[model samples]
Target: MISKTTIDNVFDTARVEEVIGDFVQLKKSGSNFKGLSPFTDERTPSFMVSPVKQIWKDFSSGKGGNVVAFLMEHEHFTYPEAIKYLAKKYGIEIEETQQTDEQKKQANERESLYLVSEFAKEYFKHVLFKTEEGKAIGLSYFKERGFTEQTIKKFDLGFSPDSWDAFTNHAIKKRYKLDYLEKTGLTIVKDDTSTGTATKMFDRFKGRVMFPIRSMSGRTLGFGGRILTNDKKAAKYLNSPESDIYHKSKVLYGIYHAKQSIAKEDNCYLVEGYTDVIQFHQTGIENVVSSSGTALTPEQIRLVNRLTQNITVLFDGDAAGLRASLRGVDLILEQGMNVKICTFPEGEDPDSFSRKNSLEELKSYLEEKSQDFISFKASLLASEAKDDPIKKADTIRDMVVSISKIPDVIKQEVYIKECARIMDISEAVLFNTLAQLLQKEQRDASRKKRSEKKTMEVVASEKKPVEKVDAQYELERKIIELLLLYGPKEEDFEELILETDEKGEIDFKPETQTKTVFRKIYLDLQEDEIEFTNDAFKELYTAITDRFMREEDLKVDDFVKVLEPEKAHAVTDILMEEEKYSLHNWERKEIYVKEKKHSVSQIVSETILNLRRELINQKIKELSETIKQQGPDDEQVNLQDVVDYITLKKLLSEKLRRVV
Candidate 1:
């Protein structure tokens, strides 16, 4: 229920680049900022943000919008949440009217779960600060572990007491539903057996220090809890079970806090635990996130890929620990990202090392010790292999397997050469091994997929991502492009018609005229009774006609903002895509792009007339089929229909000929 005035204030104050730049690594590209698409796994940046227009277009995902739209898309936020987030970030005060009872009841189930998770985070933090047990155990433990008060507050660290039903009872008293509490894995629900009348519910993270896991935009999705005791039967660390809003495979710990830093530095340091990430950031390495000791997933790798392509994984120094993380790091390599390894001294982790060393000393150690993936993996394995030929062969094969995971052919080839030089093996041999590995992997995949599907597709998954562009769609896009780019500009348009001379010969008669691009196109299409067939383009066409008729001038930003999200996205794609041609300035090189002033009539007539001709041609084809279906002895009405269709076709053909 945010007021429209508040939303406008947020829009006016928030800069699109500053907002998106927190989540994306944007490099200056002419007047816009360009970065890899956060929505797709792309190496070449197709995501473009225009400061002047206050809009962004991701050609890869076909998503484009203003600052609010980007937040809603990137953060999975509702409309009001997006507005409030921007308002808070830009220091704009929000004015919200109270919702009616019916309006409050309209909140969806997914949003309820989100509300529950957020409530749990606040409750846990309150316990840590206010309660006696929390202060003695949770706060004391964090302080003893070298976390300062600022760090604790920055991360929203919290505590869950040992008492069962403490959080559950509190949540219920606050009008939260138990269904959502259990769904988010914050409370455990148990059924009574013999009595069957009573149900048991207990706190899930009791007697633990809590770390709230957040999405990239800082919404609490789940929690990671670490136990303070060394109970032999219990697991030390427990995380919130998977829920509707939280998929562990898709979430990265500390991503919310580290996203801006990662983009600012243009590099990210991959660690293994929450404490490791916090300690690193505290010691001046802000671009860091942890996998929370879980194996890295492709989804998690792609989350980091939006900010930077380069990753320096800070692994434990032990040989076994380094070897243990190889498979996980391979997932990073598979995403077409650059990978480096920086291990701490023996028996030290990122947490210990960062806390012990000065900021400059820690940075120097990282810079001086970091090595590329191939070299790091080679030397570490070689030391373990010693002079054993079998061990060395195993090491070589392992390195080859990792190299094959790289999607970039050129990067794979470069790494293969380096591996060969380091392992002292033949490049051909390693290349053959890589080919064998890929072939076997492909076969395994085919068998698994074939088992599930009765029929196998001939096309590969990679080939299908690129959709085929239809001719009609391209033409429709071109029309919109022309109207959006040059609609307001006035230009000379020659008028020409085919005429007959005294000898019955065809001749040309041309007349000079001038009009705005909008007026000429509108009149041309209106005269023919033509309408765009595509829904998106048709909607745009209607809006354009209405605006040009009512307003003294046409403006793109106001027009784009009024369209629906999908239509707005399409408009932006067309506008931003066409900018490549519109913004291309050859005058800088002393070579001017030739103007088409004399051909303006042809350009305008062709765009409208060709579309009309296509529509007529389709009608003619339908009439021919209808005539074939009916015999020559058909009804008089059908016969008349055929004759009229033929006449219409001939007239349309003559029009096409005249234009030529």
Candidate 2:
């Protein structure tokens, strides 16, 4: 475990904006910073970071938390990993206490998998550098491809020997389990049918140069191995099988290294192979990632979308390759991102083209040749159409399908005009085509919604239970907000005790006293034995009251660290929400707004009274239901129950007017 003092130092030194700004492009928005949401695709900036509070909120995706929480969510890091990452980034030394044997033995499955993957990565790299076979075969192959030793080591490129048991034995000797080894697809096992008792076990990527595929956070999720020798019966390139950590469709090669550069440039360069990405980086173009030879997925697109709105795809002159990637272009468009295509020279792919040209020449070629996807697709299809009117019309429809995927209407309109000119069609014709496509999609969606709704209505009638949403949900939220915002402040509170006078009027006595907001709320709730009805509210109430009992200063950063992700997000939502309205700067227009702090006492009191009234109403509802389902002698209703319900309702109404 990391010592508390070290964690505090990390938190104090690592600025939230600086950490998040590495992955996102944030523009200053008044007192805070705003950026496109890393959690979702959005045109306008909705992800806000507050340096004052050390928290961030993505209104688009409803995710919010402090710096450590952001790292955990964005990188899929364990708590300790997140802390370590921050400590390393800000150069804070971490102090870890020694764990007992039992504590050490408690490593969970995911952590074990992570450890095994990491071990495999380092072991493969060691073999490529140290052993005789690795240097002669693996290092020779990389050098032959014009990759310098620095490039090879930077990407952690490695060689797996042909001897099948070499890696398997080495791993097992290190106490790594065969279960995780096989689970990660690093080792293969085959049944020994002749013996009928034991199985054959060996390495999965023997005689192949290894490319470890990593997640955005630099965790090795899997590997892509290219065979060194050409064997007709064997596959040329093989990848790790699907596991909990490695999903190829979602994992883009070089993303871990390229994310910062992509954000820095505000544009991402997309390629198709591991070498292509490494080659681009070697050639001084750092903002490049590969889809690892798979068709683009929404998840993969979203990974780049977090860093930039613009994507430039590098394609060879091969018509087949371009055709194969057309669907990927459509996926990018569907994500509401700007995509361009830059074709390399006639006989060269990104790998070879990059290796052949100087950095300036390659960058100049890209600038001269890049085209918006609309222009690229239309021109490519138009050339293929070749003055054939029917093919030209079909080509326009295909272009319309691509254009319809764009989410921004203005961009769609611009693309439509460009397509019309390229296809020699009227602008009105393309507009109609786009409208038809959108209508058909919406109609299909409506049909699905209706069918799902019909089934849901039946299921809901028969199986769904009452929601039991506390009528005081908003009140409870307000109370929590008050507790979080003003709980440390000492303020005067007036306690009212109401009694009926001899003249049948209400008499009130007020006792004025001062207490901390936390103390006042704790005592008030305790006096009435009132608990928040919502589970989250109830949990938050307990956490706050318990924390305040032993501490005077309520540090939100410290408090949020102890909470679960969901509860931490909730607390940040309350803390960060009100500051956003102020960002618009309405006060500059000479419109004054009242400060909420001045009314804190009244807001807190009214919320508590409303909550108590709601609880009473819930009881009254129970009593009325009891009467409705009662003795056969009075099936219609019971007189005593009716009188009790009416009396409770009247008392609740009186309490609603003024709290006692």
Best by TM-score: 2
For residue 102, what is the lDDT in candidate 2?
72
Per-residue CA lDDT of model 2 for 402-460, tens digit only, reads 99999899999999999989888899989998999999999999999999999999999
What's the residue-level lDDT of 348 in candidate 1?
91
**lDDT over C-alpha atoms for residue 490 of model 1:** 83
Clashing pairs in 2: none
Indicate the residue-level lDDT of 566 in model 2.
85
Residue 480 lDDT (model 2): 88
Stretches off by above 4 angstroms in model 2 are 22-48, 57-64, 97-105, 471-477, 489-506, 509-516, 526-552, 562-570, 573-598, 614-655, 658-660
TM-score of 1: 0.85
lDDT of each: 0.84, 0.85
Backbone clashes per model, in order?
0, 0
